[model samples]
Target: MGKTTGTRRGAWAAIRRLAASDRAAGLIMLGFALIGLVAANLPLTYHLFETIAETHIGIPYTNIDLPIGHWAQDGLLTIFFLTVGLELKQELTTGSLSNPKAAAVPMLCAVGGMLAPPILFMLVIALFSRFGPGEMGSLILTTTGSSIPFGEMAHGWAVPTATDIAFSLAVLALFARGLPGSIRAFLMTLATVDDLLAIILIAVFFSSVNAWYWFIGIAVCAGVWAYLVQLKRVPWAVVAVVGVLAWVMMFEAGIHPTLAGVLVGLSTPAREIHGETTPRAERYASKLQPFSALLALPIFALFATGVHFEELTPALMLSPLVIALIVALVVGKPLGIITTAWLSTHLGGLKMAKGLRVRDMIPTACACGIGFTVSFLIASLAYTNAELSAEARFGVLVGSLISALVSGILLSWQSKRFADATTDATR
Candidate 1:
């Protein structure tokens, strides 16, 4: 038994090492996503994406045939959310979010981050609508597009507000200078809050009419999962069964099935985590890491990247969607986060982290704009209609790129500056 325990520890350690390995695949994934866009525009690749989207699956008993595109967006993606929920649970329990003081700066920053982009988006629309002849005017875009660059057509406003946790956190860890651990803790907390808000937006503003029965099923399964956790059952079979049930319930719920992943994640007990005297009930939920990292997450990325770009026009490139997304993610996210963090510290009496100065704030704020996964997920969830979804996707692509580029540049620059300053001060 002791030998078996050691082996398990060894295995867990290996997994941890893999998770820590700098072969971080998100950059590769982003590269693929860029490839997907280029492919979308290419003749052969465009056709391929369209063909992939057409694939379908369904159970023997039902008329409910779900398409491959829908399945990726709906099914495997839920596991991503589940992982998010688990991380969130950990954060709330014993991670950075354990104290109200620690929580204040991130929470306020998150709110500011969420609020700014939408306002910019809406203002753009309002300007165009007020003057641009309401779809009748020939307001040509200077950015090489046929249509005007702002409107309800640009309703992809909310796409760039998300902060993709894995990618953002990974980059945060890359600083050669001794970046404050508190910054990571702070970013994670804000991103989590941003995630929860995105979920609310997806459910309330984005989804269609609910089937009450599915809601009941989701509620029941959630209750069962909670009960099982409380009962401290750890067998793989038990978890597999409950996890399956949770998936089904989420599928039935009007809420996207991917939300089940988050629910499961949040439900996990944090007591036994990494040898912290965690409750066994909390342990079962987090044990799904291998599936999440190695299988589900990567698969979801594969499917999500399958967008077609065949009918590429300058008009499309300069559309309200493209500009709004770029502005929101690139400009608004950092601006909002940095401004709010300062205000929260000064006005709300929240203290800033010890070592980080006002200059460090800009790059950190830029990093907060890394809104890849959650941004994509929300784009999928927020728009049910094909036209709307396309618009959202366009925004998501543009915004994600802008955020990643600008934020990355800022972080790298700040990291160097921080190091030089430290050296100069010592000298």
Candidate 2:
């Protein structure tokens, strides 16, 4: 019994260590994504994987019924968003974002990053319409042999605008050794703001309200949560129950349920309360980060990346939509970020963090091109046609992979330069 208990303890310790590692989390999610892709393409396993993903399991008589895939995307993914919210709150209250002067550059850069992708997407569509497979003014044909109108195709403009905070941060942690800490801070601020913008886009464009009155329940739950967290001894169980109720309300209200996680996270107090030394937001983020990193994100990646590559043809691969998405993420993201940062610092009178220059931001800009998580979510929400959606997702996957590889290489090079400079200084 003693030996067994010790082994169990050891296993638990190892699991915790893995969960806490950003590199491990990123690698695990990537591995699972590859597994999902392979599983989706293999004839023998495709049907099984599809069945598992499509199967629904939810409480009866509730509006919570969703397929396993959606449960990962909308349900389990909320935990990760909640952690993001907590981190955002901390940054706003006390971290990098607290100072308006310091925050301006990243905020503007985030706006630039968001704006460029959609413009590029529209430009690509215009080019395709004017030049490819149709008359100068006619609809462009898609890989699925459908000619969608320009307006319909434009719905996917937001798909490549997102930057996956988890993946971008993971790459930075893994490859950015010996670089300035300010770079990480800048990346975190930029990614957080990027996510905030994506959340707004999801709420504004993607939501289809069925019952507006359900927001009353959400408000009440949020109120209760705010109240509970302020108590001397917070009732964590009650807080969790209230949070679930808020999510249900949000879902029933026709808003995306994941927003509830952000709502609750923002509601959590960032200041120390009840004589606690550490703030509740920081503690909550620390506790939840492991779960978000280990399970929620990997599961979401598994379903989100299960694109059937076997179905893609060479012509489809070269489709205007695919080309646009890839270009928007890979080229537009970095271009917008670097340009905005440079303009903000040089022209707009905003200063970057000390010892940081526009040139130092190149790798960070490339890292911002990793539009995986929220990008995948937006792709599904952007298109009702299954084939179009799959193609859009494929574009996101390829674009994000290219961004990751490029950013990793750049970060390593930058780290080596920094190391060499330090060695020379020591001499």
Candidate 3:
């Protein structure tokens, strides 16, 4: 019995260590996503995979019934957003975003990043529309063998605007040897703001709130949560129950239920209280982050990335949707970030963090183009047509993959230059 217990404890310790590592978390999610994709595409496995994803499981006679895939997207993913909110709150109170002057550059760059993608998406639509159906126009056809209207296609404009913090930071951690810590800080600040903007967009554009009274329940739960977290001897069980209730209210209220996680996180006390050495928010986040990284995100990725391509034709590869996403993420993200950083420094008189320059931001800006998690969510919400949604999700996957590869190469080169410079100075 003693030996068995010891072994169980050792196994759990190993799992925790793996969960804490950003690189491990990112690789695991990628592996699961690839599994999901391959399962969706393979002739022998596709039907079973689809049935599993489409199967519904929920409490009876409540507003909670959802397919398995949606449970992954909406239910499990809320834990990830909660962690995002906690980190955002921490940054706002004590980290890089604490000072307005220092934070201006990255915040503006984030805005610029969000704005540029939609513009590029619209431009691609115009290009296809202008050159009727031979080479360019043929690429714009939907999988259903019909032309997509400009308005319908334009709905996916927000898809490429997001930046996946986990994947981007993982790439940075792996390839950014000898780079200054400020580069990581800059990426974090930019991605955090990018997440905030994406959240607002989701709330405003995607929600249909007919059951406003349910918000009263949400508000009460939040108030109780805020009160409980502030106490000297907090009851964590009660807090968890209240948090779930808030999520249920948000779902019934027709707001995206994931926002409930954000609400609870934001409400957590960021300042130390009642003889505590550390703030409650920090402690809570540290405890929950492992779960979010290891379980919540990987499950979401598995469901979100199961895109089945009907065929592997050149037209599909060069489809307007596909081309637009690739350009928006690869070219537009970095272009917007660089331009805004320059403008803020030169014209607005804002400054970057110490030991960083606008030019130094090139690789990090490229990393910002990796829009995976939120982009997938937006794609599902933006289009009701199954074909259009599939196309958009596939585009997101391809675009994020390209951004990851490009950023990795650029970061490796930059790290080499920095390392050589350090060696010469030391000699």
- Candidate 2 lDDT, 141-244, residue by residue in tens: 88766787777778899999999887898899899999998999899889888988898999999999886678788888989998998898888899989999
* Candidate 1 Cα deviation (angstroms), residue 416: 2.0
Model 2, residue 367: distance off in Å is: 0.8
In order, candidate lDDTs are 0.67, 0.88, 0.87
Q: Give the runs in model 3 whose Cα sits over 4 Å from its true position.
A: 1-9, 132-140, 312-314
Candidate 1 residue runs with Cα over 4 Å from true position: 1-16, 21-23, 131-155, 175-177, 273-287, 313-315, 384-388, 425-427
Arranged by lDDT, best first: 2, 3, 1
Q: What TM-score does candidate 1 get on C-alpha atoms?
A: 0.85
| lDDT for residue 191 in candidate 2, whole number 0-100 | 88
Candidate 1 local lDDT, 30-115, one digit each (tens): 65556656665677667787677677888566445788777766777676677677777877777777786868888888889998
User: How many backbone collisions does model 3 have?
Assistant: 0
121: Cα error in model 3, Å: 1.2
Cα deviation of 222 in candidate 3 (Å)? 1.1
Q: 1-427, model 3: which lDDT tens digit per residue?
A: 9999999999988887887787888888888888888888889988998999999999777858899999999999999999988887888888778886888899999999999888888798778766645455533565446677666888888999999989999899889978999899889889999999999999998999976679789999989999998888989899999998998888888899999999999888888888888887888888788789899988888888886777745577677787888888888899899999999999988898998889999999999999989999999999887778887887888888899999999999999999999999999
TM-score: model 3 vs. ground truth: 0.95
Candidate 1, which ten residues in sequence have the lowest lDDT sum?
138-147
C-alpha TM-score for every candidate: 0.85, 0.95, 0.95
